[model samples]
Target: MRSEGLDLFAHGMIGLNQLKAGSLDSRNSLGAILGGGMDIQIWHGIYWRAFEADYVWAALHYSDVVSPSFPDLRRPYQNGVRLRTGLVFSYGEKKAAPMTAACSVQPTQVMVGEPVTATANVSNANPKHTLTYDWSSTGGKISGKGNTAAIDTNGVAGGDYTATAKISDPKTKHGGETSCSAKFTVKELPKNPPTLSLSANPTSVQTGGSVSLSGLSHQSGQRSGQWRQLDGECRHGFRKRQQRYAEYFRRPTRTDHRERKLF
Candidate 1:
């Protein structure tokens, strides 16, 4: 730190004649002081002023008389130095950074009995202190360890839910706790099985004749279907068109007066 400001100085002198008369003269002068210092911390709010030095300049006037017979007067500008070292006391308190947290979940939507992972990201936490995490949810059971946790979605109803995590620093009494929440959805299984249909072009075919076969499948939910032809000879001719709501399969068959079953 550094400082520069106006100062006041008082000067006094004692001469042989003044000593015999048991008297002295004093004068006050105005000056400017410039100085800087170094401080080392001894403890919280307490510091040791290692060293401080100041340069002072002032204008002084004086007069001398011997027995009132003759007199001499002079005016002069003087320079002075001052050094100091001591303990310094500081007041008030220091503020700490506020704690904050953010929560997120992997796979925001899941089917029942599937596991969901929740994570907590924290900021402004003390690295030296041990942190504790508390996990909770509106639905399902949540278990947490450190910053991450797992949620068991089994037996949970089909609806939207929230997972929350509370983070805290055990060493701090105040301003060291934070909480965050994330949302997720649970879906139930479909009530009915998917519907299937099959058709063939040219219902009757002669020997070695090719018949075009088409099949369709419909489902209520987001599900895909696969197609498999039972006939080994016609398996290579089967083509599948996959979709979330419906699926289509096409194949061309060659028959030779033998009965064939399609599934």
Candidate 2:
């Protein structure tokens, strides 16, 4: 038997048994088993004050003779109702959430006015749970959704920059979040190279005489260079000097004293 209500409940059970009579002594016989219990709804799906009672019949037998002096061949009747009651609980496992978040940037080094992409990797998150992402950066413009974002470096200054990703699981029990960052480097465009020019004051010089040699550097700042003279008609090595300003060199008086280009 059972009764249902908005806040209370009751239930019961009964066991049925049967057996055949035999010419010889046998143990199988008719019996009855009955049980009943009731519980109160203490909280949402949970119940308290649950109790149950069970009664079992154990005395039925057969006789081989009609004499009353013979001892009863079957066991004595068991007439006790066992009762039990306790508190009942209902619960479930806690929800998993995002514990740690990490991110990475592609092409970590780039020139000004370049582009980079960032991706996020989350840990300790439930596979079936939905997640949302928020992205930020210390330099450049950022656009993102879920676990991915883009960084535009147009008109951005040259230096190291960082991008961050914040991850959250909306269905988490604790409403926890994690954040991670990635770094990238940027450099300005290259500049034109330096240049050098050399000139000799006297186009021609007499044997055993010296000529004034000078040079200029297109690049600003202190400069140091080398000057060298080459022999012609039968190419041969000559004198060389290391200087910053004008340098005087005596013309060679040897047999190969012909005019030649100075480098």
Candidate 3:
């Protein structure tokens, strides 16, 4: 394979030469061969092939003896180096690139003024490529870096919002841009202070007798309040004259009266 499959070679050969006149001689000689050379692909297959070549190498010598004196005539080897060329074929199924990106938001529901974070997962992207991130939301200010983004819902309207993340390999020639979306809900904080009203099952109760005092509000959840009991003597003359309720009440003495907590 020297010369990268292109070249020529010459060498010497030795053989025995015998004459019918009972004269034996040894033929030891050197020679050279020159011929136009080319290689052609003979057959094509997955693993094997066939090839062929044609060439000639020979030498001729003459004797000047006028009488029959020489024992035998010497001849050069006639066969030259032969080469074979083959063809190869390979077959296989092709596969597509696995470029993809996905996104997810934690705690899909949040109150206004709370911060929510979104994360992106990328697969089959070249690590050597420079990646870019784009984040967008329907109802919040989203700030992004890398594969993560922060959603600020401080002034955002209360409703279901959809957040999207697009991851791009800008350096890639095909420009692999994959995106995914996640939905979240934002609830506005209660604006109106709780509107409460108090009432008793029995407006008038005898001394040492208990009456159920109930309160109502617009809000839901646990509520706490301090309860104080008032004596009839605390009523002013104008309230008494007008048959109105007293403005100020007495401090509660029992633990059960002051410890008013409800849900």
Q: What lDDT score belongs to each candidate, Candidate 1 first? A: 0.68, 0.64, 0.59
In candidate 1, the residue pairs with backbone N, CA or C atoms under 3 Å apart (3 or more residues apart, or in different chains) clash, namely none
The RMSD of every model to the true structure, in order and in angstroms, is 12.1, 15.6, 16.0
Q: Pick the candidate with the highest lDDT.
A: 1
TM-score of 1: 0.54
Candidate 1 residue lDDT tens string, 1-263: 31111122333433221112235456555556676667776665677778877776765555453343333325556678989888888788464678899999998999898999999999988877789999999989999999999999999999999999999887766687999999999988666544566787887666566667755545444334454545544344444222321322233222222232333
The TM-scores, one per candidate, come to 0.54, 0.42, 0.45
**Candidate 1, after superposition: displacement of residue 133 in Å?**
0.5
Residue clash pairs of candidate 3: none
State the local distance difference test value for candidate 3.
Answer: 0.59
Off by over 4 Å in 2: 1-98, 193-263
The residue pairs in collision within model 2 are: none
Estimate, for each residue in 1-263, the C-alpha lDDT of model 3 and write its tens digit: 21212233333444433222234333334444333333332222232334344354544333432234543443324556666555545356233375798889987998889999999998988877778988999988999999989999999888999989888876554537889899999987654333346776688767666555555433332233343545564334323422321211222222222323221
| Stretches > 4 Å off in candidate 1 | 1-94, 222-263
Query: Model 1 lDDT vs. the true structure?
Result: 0.68
lDDT tens digits, residues 1-263, model 2?
Answer: 32221234334444444444476444555566666667665654566756767676656554543355645644335466778787766477233343788899998988788899999988887677788898999999999978999899998889999999988876654545788999999876645333456676586766655666655445422223344556543122123334212242232122222333334
Comparing 1 and 2 on TM-score, the stronger one = 1
